[model samples]
Each structure stands twice: as structure tokens, then as C-alpha cells.
Target: MKPLKRILRILKTISLYALLLIYLSPFFFVLINSFKSRREIISNPFGLPDVWSLDNFVTAFQKMDFVSAFVNSLVITFFSVIGIAVFSSMTAYIFVRTDWRFNKVMFFVMVAAMLIPFQAIMIPLVQIYGGLNLLNSRWILIYMYLGFGSSFAVFLYHGFIKAIPLELEEAAMIDGCSRIQVFFRIVFPLLKPTTLTLIILNVLWIWNDFLLPSLVLISSSNRTLPLTTFYFHGTYTSDYGLLMAALMLTILPVIIFYAFLQKYIIKGVMEGAVKA
Candidate 1:
């Protein structure tokens, strides 16, 4: 029995390692090709670079207008995430604390909305906003993100908020705090873990989103990193080395952000699950 268990454990470890390698292979391919020349990338993509160079990165940065794109991405993601977190948390709090039939119905509607895919509404949504001349603006993009992102955020916050004791809010109100004060001071602070989880999740989604931005933002000056990366592809040809480098630059910030806050994701989910 001991011998059999040891063999099984070894097989499991090997399987896990193999899966990790499979997931990381694409990223490694991009990283390797990012350092090579265009000709080398085209001729021998799998081979190591003859001479590691920063030229592709420099050219990609210049051509993509990296700084402007980065700032646009940052602003859209920041505002969208903030709006989602704030509005969703407040909505969840109202649903949890109040016994209103309207609140219950609205909550159910929002949850049902999540079941509808963005692809289903994509064309109509774009056309409606475009007809209004509301397209191609960062503020409009952020507003749309908030509308789309809130449902899931509210769902997460709803479960977590239910786990918080109503007694805490009652105590604050009894001690001369207004309803607003009670929530801001007592309930909101306790929502830290859940809020952090939502922020990171929404940041990753909004930052990497391409299709929505492409439909909404028509101007080059307002493009995000994902949109800017499209510059590497032309009608008849593409710059593979520059494209890889651009991809690396576009993904690096979110990768770093995720790496640092990854632990909180599980922590928040676990806490909400256990408490809910």
C-alpha cells in the first residue's frame, strides 16, 4: 500500500508540473521572440535570438504611442473599477439590510442580466451609443464598463455583505451615527477583503478588454494598450517581433498586479463562502 501511494503521488506531481508548463508555454514563446529581430522571428521563431536586442521594444513603444495608451488604459480601468466597487457594495448593503420587495426584484434582475453574454448585445449597444454621438470617449467607455461590470461585483458583495452582522450597524446608529455614517464607518471597513478582490478582478477585466474598446474608441489618441498593439499588424504584413514586444508591455502591469494580490483572491472567496 505504501509503495502504491508513493507512485501515485509522484504521478500527480508530474501531471501538475506538465499542466503548469502547458499554461506557461505561450508566455515563454512571446518573451523569447520579443528579443529577436523581425527576420529572425519570421525565419526561425522557435530558435534562440542571435543577439538579444531592445530595438523591437523601442520601436514598438514609439509606434504604438505607448505612454498615451498606457494612460488611457489606467484611467478607464481605475474609474471603472472604483465605480463598480462603490456602487455594487452600496447596492449589496441595501439588499442585505432592507426587506423591500423592490430591492429583491432589482437584485434578481441584475443577477439575471449576468447570464446574458456581451456578444448578444454587442451590435445593438454599439449602434445605440454611436447614434447618440457618445462613442470614442474615455468617460463613455468607463461608464459602459461600470454598467457591464456591476452585476457580478454586486453578486460577490451581496454574499459577503450577508455575512456581516447587522448588530454592528445598529450599534453605530445608536451612538449618534447617521445611516450613512453607520455604513461608511462600520459596514464599509469590514468589506475590505471583498472590495480588494473585486478591484483586482475588475482591473484585470477592464484593462485587458479589447472588443468593447475597439467598438467604442475610434480615435488613435484614446486607444488603450490592447488597441495600440494593433498597430503592429498592417494590411499585407505584420511585425511579429514588435507585436510580441507590444504584447509583453501590455500584459506586464496586470501580471505584476495579479502576482502581488493573488493571495487575497482566495482569501476573499473563502471568507465569503464560509460566512455566506
Candidate 2:
């Protein structure tokens, strides 16, 4: 019996490591290949670089216009997160606190909107933005993000708000505070966990988005990180070395940020999950 148990444990450990390597193989390939020269990469990508070169990363920075793209991504992501958090929180609070007929209907409509696919609406979105003269502007992306993101954000907030105590707000009302004052001063502060979750999710979406930004951004100068990487794939061919280096640079920040803040983000999600 003891020998059988030990054999099972050993097999489980081996299986776990196998799965880990399978998931991480792409990163390993990218890291190893990034060090190789374009010719060496093409010849034997699986092998180590004969001579390590910073040239791929150095060249990518210049050709990819990394600085401008980074700035554009930062600006778009920052505003998008803020807009999603504030608007969704406010909307959620109103709907959750009231029993109004219209508010209930509106909540269902918002949830239904989440079922609509982005591809189905992309043509109409482009047309609307064109008519509104919002083409080629970063704000257009932010606006679209807020509209698309609010449904989920509000959904999260609504559940978390129910779990929060209503007595605190009632006490503030008795102290002559209006509903607005009670919300910001009393209830909003209690929603910190949910807000953090919303911020993290919205940031991730806005930061890594490629399709909409590529379509809307008119110039290479206005490109985000993902859009900037497109130049790596030329019509005739591609520079795989520089492309991998740029890919590393683009993802490093997001990985680092999530690693540090993921604890709070996880707690927020768990705490805010609506129990049916």
C-alpha cells in the first residue's frame, strides 16, 4: 500500500511539472530566440545565441517608436479605467438602492448589451465615430471602452453593494446628509475592494487592445504597443528577432504590475462575486 501511494504521488508531481512546462514553452522559446541574430534565429531557433546581442532590443526601440506608443497606451488606459470605475459605480449605486421600474429595466438592458459581439457592431461603430468626427482620436477609444465595459463593472458593483450594510447610509441621512453626500462619504468608501477589481480589469483590457486601436488610429505616430508591433511583420517578410524583443518589452510591464497587485485584485473579485 505504501509503495502504491508513493508511486501515485511521484506521478502527480511529474504531471504537474509537465503541465507547467507545456504552458510556459512559448515564453521559453521567445526568450531563447530573442538573443539570437536574425540569421541564427532563422537557422536554429531552438539553440542558444552564439553571441548575445542587445541589437534587437535597441533596434526595436527606434523602429517601433516605443516611446510614443507607450505614452499613447498609458493615456488611453488611464482614462478608460477611471471612466469605467466612476460611471459604473455611480450607475450601480443608483440602481441597487432604488426600486424604480425604469432602473430595473435599465439594468436588464445593460446586461443584455453584454451579449452583443464587438465584431457584429464594428462597422456601425466606425460609421458613428466617422460621423461624430472622433476618428483618429484616443478619446474615441476611451469612450468606446466605457460603454462596453460598464455592463460588467456595474454588475460587479451591484452585487458588492448588496453585501455592504445599508444602515450606515441611513444613519448619515438622519444626520441631514443628502443621498449624494451619503453615497460619496458613507457608501463609496466601503466599495474600495470592488473599485480596485474594476480598475485592474479595465486597465488590462485598454492596455492590450489591438483591433479597435489599429482601425481607429490613422498614423503610426498615434499607435499603441500592439499596433506598433505590426511594422515588424512586413509585406515581404518579418524581422523575427526584433519582433520578439518588442513583444517582451510590451508585456513586461503588465506582468510586473499584475504580479504585485494581484492579491488585492483577487480578494476584490472573490468578495464582490454575487451569490445566486
Candidate 3:
């Protein structure tokens, strides 16, 4: 019986590893194939490269102008993230702490706005962007991101805020802190985990977004990293190697960032959800 149980445990472990490999094999394939030359990729699709080369990386950079596009994406994502976190945090605090006649009405309105589809408003948004003379600028996209990011961020913050006892702020106020200082100094620090979650979530969404940026940013140089696939697809029509290399480069930064920060993201999400 002991021998049989030990064998079963080993088999279960093997099966778990097999499932993990099955899920991750696609990424492993891309990472390996991105280094292979065009001919080698076509001739031996799943095998190791005949000779390792950086030619595809060079071509992808030159063809897609990867560096400039990445810079545009980073800048747009940064501002959008900051604006969303600050606006949403302040707004959520107002909703939670204030005693206004319209408090409940405003919260319901935010919930309703979350239900509205972006497609329904795209035309109006485009016209507004055009009117602002922001059709080819990153700022338009940043603002749009703020609008979309707000609904979710507010909900998360609102939930997390409920778990915070009001007496903490009352005690701070008793100690001579002003309303703004009580919030910025005391209540705000307690909400750090939720804010961190919002930052990560908004940054990921704004960074990987392609459709909105495509519509708002028409110029090649102003294009976001994901949108750079426009010319990459058109120009490298027959070269799968170059296409895959570009794809890999675009995904690497996201993967690296998530690898280090994912612990905090998960912790924040769990704390906010469970405590709310």
C-alpha cells in the first residue's frame, strides 16, 4: 500500500508539471523562435535555430521604430495612471466620507457609467478629440484612459475605504489636523495597497491598449508599441521571423514588469476584495 501511494504521488506531480508545460509552451516557443533567422523559422518551425542571430531584432527595431514607439507608450501610460489614481482616490474618498444629498445618486451614476460600452461613444469621442486638435497626440489617449480607468478604480477604492474605521480620521482631527491633512496624512496611507493595485491595473490597460491609441494617434512616430504592428504587419508580410521578433519585443517589458510587481498586485486585489 505504501509503495502504491508513493507511485500515485509521483504520477500526480508529473501530471501537474505536464499541465504547466502545456500552458506555457507557446511562450517558450516564441522566446526561442524570436532568435532564429527567417529561413530557419520557415524550414524548422518548432526546432532549435540553426544559428542564433540578432538580425531579426535589428530589422524589427528599424522597421517598427520600436524605441520611439515604446517611449510614446510609456509616457502616455504614466500620465494616464497618475491621473486615474489621483482622481479616483479623491473621488472615492468624497463618496465614502461626505454626507451630501447627492452622495448615493453620484455613486449609482458611476456604477451606471461603467456599464456603458465604449463603442457607443467612440464617434463622439473621436469628434471631441479632433476638436481639441489632439488627433495625433498622446495626451488625448491619456485623458480617454483616465475616463475609462476611473470607474474601476473608484469601485475598488470605495470598497477598500469601507473597511477603514472612521474613528482613525476622527482621532487625527482631534489632534489638530485639518480635513485635507487628515486625509493626505492619515487615511491616505492606509489605502496604499488599493492605490498600488489601481496603479498596476491602469498601467497595464493603458500600456497594452491598441484600438484607442490607433484612432487618436495617426502619425507613425506617435504610435503606441502595440499599434506599431501596423507597419510591422504590412512591411514584413512574408517574414514570420521578423513579425514574431517584434511581437516578442513588445511583450518583454510587460512580462518583466509584471514578474517583479505581480506579488503586490495580487496581494492588493485580495485585500481590497476580501476586506471590502
lDDT of each: 0.86, 0.83, 0.84
Deviation from truth (RMSD, Å), model 2: 2.3
In order of appearance, the predictions have TM-scores of 0.88, 0.91, 0.90
Q: Candidate 2: deviation at residue 178, Å?
A: 2.6
Q: Lowest-scoring 10 consecutive residues by lDDT in candidate 3?
A: 267-276
Candidate 2, clashing residue pairs?
A: none
Candidate maximizing TM-score: 2
The better candidate by TM-score, 1 or 2, is 2
Q: What residue runs in model 3 are displaced by over 4 Å at the alpha carbon? A: 268-276
Mind giving the per-residue lDDT tens digits that candidate 3 earns over 77-196?
Answer: 899998998888888888999878698788888878888888888899899878978688777778888888888788888888878899989998999999888888987788887888
Q: Which lDDT tens digits does candidate 1 get at residues 1-276?
A: 699999999999999999999999999999999999788998998988999898888988888889999999999999999999988898899998999999999999999998999999899999899999999999999999989998988899899888887787888888999988888888888999888877766776788898999999999999998888775455214678888888888878878876887787667556545543
The count of backbone overlaps in candidate 3 is 0
Flag the better candidate by TM-score, 2 or 3: 2
Sort the candidates on lDDT, descending order.
1, 3, 2
